[model samples]
Target: MNFRIFKYLIPGMAVILMTGACSGNGANGVNGNAASGSSGPNSQAPAGKEVKISFWHIYNTGPMKELYDKLIDEFEEAHPNIKVDHAGYGIFDLGDKLATALAGGTGPDLAMDGIDGGQLKIKAGTIVNLQPYIERDGVDTNQYFPLLIDIMKQEGNGDLYRLPLETDVRVLFYNKEAFREVGLDPEKPPTTWEELESYSDKLTKWNDKTKLLDRIGFAPNLGNFWYWTLAWTNGVDFFDDQGNPTLDTPENIEAAEWWVKMQNKYGTKAFSAFQSQSGSLGFDPFVGGKVAMEVSTNNLVSEIKANQPDLEYGIAPIPIKKNNATWSAGFSLEIVNNKDQAKADAAWELLKFLTSTEIQKRHHIAGNALVGNRLAATDPEFMKDPDWKTVTDQMQFTRFLETPIEAQGWGGQMWKNVQAAVAGSMTPEQAIKTSQKETEDLIANYKKTS
Candidate 1:
């Protein structure tokens, strides 16, 4: 199996590849005969017969794990015929374990994971096509955010293999205290690239004698900042309509050059040294007051509340250039390919129950995550919080980059070129050109072998 393809199957911009081989567990420990039925809201299993479906997820700890278990219990109570054998796996271990299990025909009936890995499973023929079930059950795809649905259909001839579960959108997080200290208006955040640069300069502090950075205003690579987001903000798309690499476009080059310039301004070595110091001390640069502003996702709000509840902070859309766009990514629920039709039907029932508005709202509140379900996302109860409202408001402008399967390995390769440009080993134009050629070569080679 090509693990490179699975490595990019992460939930968001951060990619972690699990290379260790995992051993399979048989039938997820089923204890009873599986029962088949229509997957409608009113569907019920016959008396004296029960179906057991195994479910695997990465929410292994904290409130999310507890909430998941509680939901499973509720689901079982509502449909006594369906019993779910829920299991938790480390996020890093899921890809390899799932791949191994599916290959051995011992995988779970249903799984929730990032779209990237789900795509690899689809390509490997290890996941079921959910279109038939969706149509038969009259599942309304309209209930979900359109972008989430679009990403799920990007694989296998536009077939819907997974249902989006939750998602996060990137935004700007600023320390209001830092802005006040810098003599800038605490209520207003930078709205444009030029304004952001000016604010960053004013907010940054340095020691004249030691030549060390005292505080950083913003770092392009900090938190969840992705070069793709920056490029998109500058009116660039990394791929063309035909799914070809378009990294060498003028707008992309400009974005890369701008990032490198920001790094050079603070001295890359010094900036990295400061970042290392923060990491080594177990401190978040932003939360610890080492950095005044950062580009981060909705999750940062929870982190801030947990780490420094009293910190005066503000959330705003990421400073933009050509458009009010931000990058978005999230997880989806998929039913693994199974030989037993009964187990497949049971899994579909569970999938619908989990994605239903009430259940989704409960999950979002318990986890403080942005759910993909429109009703849950727009619920006034959850949107009452200012921070969440600010994050959710940008959904209309959020964009999801659908990477072509043939170019699955492009992310890591492109990051290397980005590093080269940041280190001054190559110009931004040269870096992008090199990355484009290498990606095109990779796609061509993959096609020949596939």
Candidate 2:
């Protein structure tokens, strides 16, 4: 599993308030729980024979772990004869262990991992194609975001390989109090790059005598925001139509330069020193009123609520440069190919219950997350919340990053290059050019083997 998945999947502290609300029918118009007699191949445990399936996942702690345990207890009660042997591990450890187990033909029947890792397993033939089971159960794939479900389909054969668990979009989080303090209207936030720069200037504070920044109005590389997000906003794709890396294109170079400019305005050394202090402060700078604005996902709500519930803030669409765009990414659940037909069926049942409309709604409300199931997100009960409305409304401009398989580990390398540019070790053009060459070489090596 990716480290990013760990951040997104952990439920907020608010979830503890909704622990009683997990049971409900699926969005597909069927009961999501096996105890409700939902029609499916594994809806009921095999007659006169007990069946067991193993489930492993990265949600090892926090409210999410507790929520899953509660759901599992209900599942076992509903299907008296079917047993689930489930365990949790550190995300990286889980990925390593899962790979080793699959190689040894002893992997669990069901597991959860980052979408890319799941895709790799699918290509390797260790993960099961879920299309047949989806068809058998009449699951309404239409209920999911088209982009999300589309990505799950195999490139050539269109076989669905994994199911998305949660989806999220980036948003601009501004401290309303900071806005008031800076003489900017609390209701008006920056909508374009120009405005963001101007607003940030006013919102930033400096310790005049020390010639150091007291606070940053906006930090381009901070929080969950990624450099690729700016590339997309500027209408540049990481790759060309030929599936080759295009990181150093004119458009991308411009975007990287803009990001570098923002860092330079604060003086790299002074900014780096301030950032180190902020980290030692042991809380999100936004929640601590140290940053006037931040680009982050809805999950930041959890941090605010947990640390300083009284902080007033506003959420808005990300400021645009060349286009109105943001990226969505999330963790997904996958079923491993099991030789025992009964175990396979049982794994599907567990998956169905987790994604059902009722459970998905609970997930959204409890965790402040955007679920893959559109029905769950748009429910009348959840739609009433303004924060949910803000995030979901931006879904129209949201898109998934479509990295080609040949460039599987490209992001880590790209991040290092981007960091070098931000820290002033290299020029933006130099960093992007170096990344472009490295990524192209990666694709070439993959082609030689594949």
Q: Give the distance in Å from residue 19's predicted Cα in candidate 2 to where it truly belongs.
A: 35
Q: Write the per-residue lDDT of candidate 1 for residues 1-450, one digit (tens) a residue.
A: 232222233333323321211222222222111112323212443234698999998888888899999989988898898899998888767766766666666778898767544555554455667777777678899888887776667553467878888888999999999999979999999999888899999999997987888889887878887777788899987776666778888888888888888767788777877877778646478888888889988887777767888999999999988988887877788776565667777888889998989889988877778888988888998778887888899899887664565776576677678879988899988988898999899789878998
Global lDDT for candidate 2?
A: 0.73
- Between which residue pairs do clashes occur in model 1? 9-116, 9-117
Give candidate 2's error at residue 334 in angstroms: 1.2
Model 2 CA deviation exceeding 4 Å by range: 1-48
Best by TM-score: 1
lDDT of 2 by residue, 12-123 (tens): 2112211211222112211122222334344443545688899998667877788878889998887777789999888667756776676666778887755433444443
Please identify model 1 stretches exceeding 4 Å from their true place. 1-48, 116-120, 156-159, 281-283
Each model's lDDT? 0.75, 0.73
